[model samples]
Target: MELPIDHFRLLGVSPATDGQTVLRTLQQRLDRAPDQGFTHETLQARADLLRNSADLLSDDRHRTAYEAELTALSAEGEGGQSAIPALEIPNSKEVGGLLLLLEAGQAQEAFEKASRGLQPPQAPALGSSREADLALLAGLACQGAAEDYRQQRRYEAAARVLQQGLQLLQRMGQQPEQRRRLDLALEALLPYRVLDLLSRDLSASLERNEGLQLLEQLVRRRGGLEGESDAAFPASEFQPFFKQIRQFLTAQEQVDLFSRWAEAGSPLADFLASIALTASGFAQRKPERLQAAYGRLAGSGQAGVEPFLACQLLLLGQIEPAQALFEQGADPALRQWANEQGEEPLAGLCAYCRDWLEREVLPGFRDIEADPDLEAWFADRDVQAYVEQQDRKRARSAPLHPPEAAAGAGAGTPSTQSSLDAMPLWPGDPLASGLAAPSQPGQSGALSEPLQPEEDEDDWPDLALGWPNLHWQDLQLAERWAQLRTSAAELLAQPPSWVLPLAVAVTLGGVGVGGWLALRPKPERGQPIPVLPAPDGTVQTGAKPSPAATGAPKAAASPGAGAPGAPAPTPAPPAPRNLPLTVAKPSSAQLRSLLEAWLAAKAAVLAGATPEHPLEQLARSALVGNVESQRRENASRGESETVTAEVRDFSVTSQTPQRIEAEVTLRYSDARKDANGKLIASTPEGERRNTYVFARDGQTWHLAAFRASR
Candidate 1:
């Protein structure tokens, strides 16, 4: 007979047993599986189950209670009494329709319909067929329901249903499909569960107390059995799911997991060993362990070879090698060349390395290179000096760095400076002149190699990347930006008032033509506008109306209409007059106040300290400043800044809530110098651009963009 479904029984133990005992027993079973007629599927499945169950038992409460109960059961009876639970296999045809219907997302309805229309069972009297099928159907139905719930983001309900389904599937050992379905359901549910817990638990975990403890517990519980596969089920079908689990492991505190898996020589032992070694090296900052971990990956011949190779180079701190591999592997030559020219090539490699180190290596390490404790472990004085010098040099030359590179008293000392300037191609060479041994015959090329290029940011070294120095490119870019700035200033010098009205008329003409076609009547029923009405007294339809008949109103006879009922035409109404505007000229005191307000606004935007939204505050303050400055100028005060006293000939044509139009003339004398009080240029040379604008809010106006006159 097949083994019972109870994990304890399968392991030849009672429920009261501890995880350690259970684990040992399971290992022994795995070791002898080949000789015991266990298929690969069965063996792997059982191993996964054992590993997962042992992990579950690691909790203090669970372990304690489970062991106590198992011990009591052991004391009660032996052999047949404590049988491992056997899974009931459902007949293929029996649950076939149910499975398909459940797959279609109609599980509950399908189950109810099948139950109500059940046919009498043809099974033996040993067990009730109706009961067995119902149990099986109920389990499948719950899993299907859970999937629906998960899709709708009802995660808590999904988790509950999934947990129940998994339990039921465990009892339905006879049905492989049921087992498979349950595994898939759990795989899908686990990610959402982990994410939800993380959102709530991340802050607590950051704290030093029980906060991190709770997060760790939730991570283990949610992410632990993620990669476990059902033996009776096809695990390969869920490769993407397994990949996701592996990703989650990188983000959590997984040392305990790695150690346990390594000790057990589990199928994941290779990966775990790598994580363990790399983590230790990273935490300790020991390069050897880091190198060793990478070496292990090289031997694996796995598909994720890029990450492994990258890890080794990164740990060794050989950026160029890793960069070469990444470029060659991830892109075409043209794209790769372009990428190299940009910052992305090196940056991408570095980001990838950082992420891997963060995940698999010492999850706790921060600033791995500078950690003094790690540095002290390397006993070689020369290597230490070499590494330190290289780091300092790198810190100096690294692009886009903050001012930290230029700080520190000995930051640019000769010893450190040379290492930072080492040629990328000469990675193995010491920064100091440690010459190579004399070359043999036919090795003259090596001996005659030219001295390295001068250590200047603009100069190229022997390496290909260093050859096309980025400094020249940056200088070119700066020059282009300067030219653009000058062009923009010239453009802004021209006034907008003259350009806007003509552009508006042109735009309106186009709109009018388009509107005419849409608004005018179209020829319908093969009838078109005729030149005149027919000769008869009757007016023919479809004729264009004459000017007099086009709503112009008929003229009256000499004095008045002869008809007694006729009334004189009402006098035509006159068009409304536009409101006049008032303009102000700014003086020194007003100018100072306006500039002060504007400067404050600008400073606030930069500091992010402004009470109002930065841009809104900027616009409002600018308007106030402009209005105040206009007022000051109109008062004929002394020339201020670039603005001077002029013949304040200004006029306002219109002033409505939605529209404003104005004209002004401005002139100024030489203003005072800058804060240093030097002699300033004469003539008020600043240009003033006038604009008529439609306003949304009565107090604020946004300039509708218009083209400049050619």
Candidate 2:
């Protein structure tokens, strides 16, 4: 008879058990067989099965052979994948459906389905071989799904799913290898999960603290919290990764985090604490913090901090020393370019440092959208902000701006000049605030590449994106921007080399249109000739003049210069009144109210409800078409969403009396669910920056156009 159970399962013992324990366990089971209420025949058969498994496992040769077979089967069950895949299990309707979903590249859907199937009353029995296949399938689905989430930067969800999967597998207990893999995956996700928590909104203190605790645990394994390397994390990536996450915290938070590390009294702690101080200095524009940062670096016992120290010096207006250190690090080609800009050597030096400096050395606070709550919180602090016209009025003052790019050490350093004349302190911006790397279409928030080796040095470098939009400086920023625009337009204007024949056709078509206008026959004199205006802004004339032509009916003598019986000329359309407009506070409030009501209606529409407002009142004209298409697309995927929308940065960029052109950042969040109430998609938060136009009648504005910024 073919027994479906493996030796481990049959014996109810782990592979780790010794041979003596295996045999003793079998003997003990046999002695207690009658307690199971089995008849003599059944008892004997049970004894035989237990004894047979024990005998095979008791011998080293038989145990090794059996394990080899099990390994081969395990590999086959796990799809023999180097990268994780859904476990290849014995076919059943549920398992087959799950696998098919995975095969179709719908990992989230597969994950949801598998999660539901593996829980509660739906979960299969644990004893049989068939049930074990389902168990392994559940583990595989969790792993594969978590991997997909990790790739999408959803580290929190990935770690949670992996942890749950690991616990589930431990309860199932047959596959040691599957359990180990799940544990490893969970371990790998810990650091990313911590990063995600730290990078989120600062108000989430509970989550951030949890991340900190996890971080402390990670360090403890390396040696302790003050160790130079990490156990789970790579040593090489330690500095840059920590530096990136530091920028996402406020100055107060940085100081607090550093204080914790400073108490540890190790070189690693000193280095980490120094990083916090440097970031805090920039965040609060505090000279004391910058000096403290430099002092802490001495205790760090770290090497290669010359560049960072140099930047600190520049910010403090130690121009001569800063300039020397900066130039020493410059590559040969860059040095040549710097030497070439002799007229304004400072400008070129600043551009090179700003563009070419490694991001690891750039330290600052979180760059979050302005919020009323955060503003209120910042206001009560003793710290001085950078935006005020006078820095001396504040309790905290500093040489906020950087030193001049090239140093004469006279009165012209950035730190000595008025804030407006120089760059704003770091809180204002490392470069300039509003003009910082203004996004062009398709280039939003992306860092452009540095100039190619063969590129002309005199031309604007792609890396110097902020230079073009930076209007206040004496730099010809606007002109450079125009040059780039003109260059792009010229490239787009030219026809493809292969499309010469199409160009020929376009030329012929132009000629044909002109010829048609010239060669057309003139209307007969008495055949109801229509009145028309002359191209030279005069009334049309016929060989026979009308009574109105001599100004008898002055208004009627305008365009309709033919006989008085001719049909009234179309009244001259009023001259288009196009002028730029600034959206006022009252208009802003009105539009915001309208948008909120519109979004509520849209949610109903997406959920398959036809509201009484009929979408026209909610989003008429141009918005209606966009709403309808979006609804249809979601519906095709068996999806629906209940969205909450908020608009920001609202402005009326331009307008006519009848039409208002505006732009806004639409912030919304939604969890999209299918017909079965299963989540198909989710965005905790999203922002859509775009411009739209509205047509106005009397009081109501009709949406005329809706489009994204890029």
Strongest candidate by lDDT: 2
After superposing candidate 1 on the true structure, give the runs of residues whose Cα lies further than 4 Å from its correct spot: 1-126, 148-160, 172-177, 190-194, 197-200, 203-710
Model 1: lDDT to the true structure = 0.38
> How many residue-pair clashes does candidate 2 contain?
0
In the range 294-380, model 1's lDDT, one tens digit per residue, is 555444433324434654554454545555545543424223222322123543343344434433343322223222122133333
Cα-based lDDT at residue 36, candidate 1: 22
- Full-model lDDT for every candidate: 0.38, 0.48
Model 2: per-residue Cα lDDT over 1-710, one tens digit each: 12234666666678999899998888776676433122343345456656777898999999999888788777877895543223223234444445434434556566566666667777767575445655655666778889988999999988888887777667667557777888888878777887898887768989888887776666555554324555556544554455456556665665666567556654445554565566555445565676567656633434434444545544443344455655654444334434422223343343333321112223345642221121222232232222221222110111222234224434443323322333332233433222333323332222243222233334534424643222222233233233323322332122111100000011111132112112222212111111221111112234523312211110101112223353332333333211211233226445544444555556667667774355576444334554676689888987776655455456666554544556665554556788899987665544455555455534455444444443
